[model samples]
Target: MDNLGMVFGLTGAAIAALFAGIGSAVGVGIAGQAAAGATSEKPDLFGKVLVLQLLPGTQGIYGLLIAFITLSRIGIMGGQAPTTVQGLLYLAACLPMGFVGLGSGIHQGKASVAAINLVSKKEDQFGKAMIFPAMVETYAILALLISILSIFGIK
Candidate 1:
């Protein structure tokens, strides 16, 4: 039973890292394709496109933070195993960041692709174009805040 609690805690941590990494990979890959295509034609837009491509990557970092916090809280990093209920709470705590990061990262990637195309076509519209993807980042940030708060709130 005690071992099972640790298992649940570890599982939550792994899920946080795994799902978030997948999301970031998908998002970065999608955005990178668009960035490459845009930069090929308008090499001067490299900096702007590169930034857009990197936007989705932040979700992965957020996920990693959640995982680290979960591990520390659960004693996985070097402490006593959590009780079953505590372990379950930790698992629940990781859910928001993992799920939201996945969704937001992919959506942000799509937004970045659109922004990249817009900037490629209208260089002067770069500021406005950046707004779309930047907007997507707000959701990821929100999820991160919620996940962090949840983890911290768990005694």
Candidate 2:
């Protein structure tokens, strides 16, 4: 029972890393399929498509960062363990990043697929195409910011 707080904190860290990683994997897989098809037709577009395919991956990194921070904060990485209330607070703080990363990564992937198609058809529009998927990244960034702020704010 004394270690319950540590368990909760660890769960929070796992949730942050796991959900975001799953989202990124799915997003990258979807975008990779589209990118492969596009590049098959025009190898020169590889660079452009690759960039779009990787855009959704940022959320996973953000999630990982949150997890690391949470772990460190709670002393899982090496310090005093948190109380149950503090552990719960950490869990709550991680939620935004987990949920938002999941949704945004998937949507961003779809957006990247569309952008890939657009670029495949009109190579000159690469700049404009990049914007579509990049827009989805905003929510993930916002969630990351909130998670970071919340975690650090927790005493």
Candidate 3:
């Protein structure tokens, strides 16, 4: 690929990573606020709320991992650049994590908040409450897998 193609590929990957980070930030922020509110009322639920808050962070880690892998494939990590179409494709593979992770994280946060409320009131059903939002995280994992496979498969 040409220099411009590599640039575009890198840009896409950076943007994807940024979006994923932002998604995680937003998701964690929302969940944290709600969790704090809940904790104030029920100090005993701190551990559960903390777990829920952390769940959203997984997407950001996935994005960062994909970006690093993509960069590695292009030799970007070692201060070199992609010089082939396949290398460009590897960089482009970083896009899915951002799009999927962003929305999924937010939705997951909302669900988790609802779940937290349910669990807080009915301690016996904590598992049931946690499951709904955790399930939403499955999409983020799928996106990460696709991005990783695409980057590796391309080159």
Which has the better lDDT: candidate 1, or candidate 2? 2
Q: Tell me the tens digit of each residue's lDDT in model 2 across 1-155.
A: 88777788888888889888888888999999999999999999999999999999998999999999988878778767998988888898999999899998999999999999999999999999999999999999999999999988988
Clash totals for all candidate models: 0, 0, 1
Better of 1 and 3 by lDDT: 1
- How does candidate 2 score on lDDT? 0.91
TM-score of 3: 0.90
Residue clash pairs of candidate 1: none
lDDT of 1 by residue, 128-155 (tens): 9888988988888887898788878877
Most lDDT-accurate candidate? 2
Q: Model 1 — which ten-residue stretch has the worst lDDT?
A: 71-80
Per-residue error (Å), model 2, residue 46 = 0.5
Segments of candidate 1 deviating more than 4 angstroms: none
Model 2 TM-score? 0.98
True lDDT of residue 134, candidate 2: 97
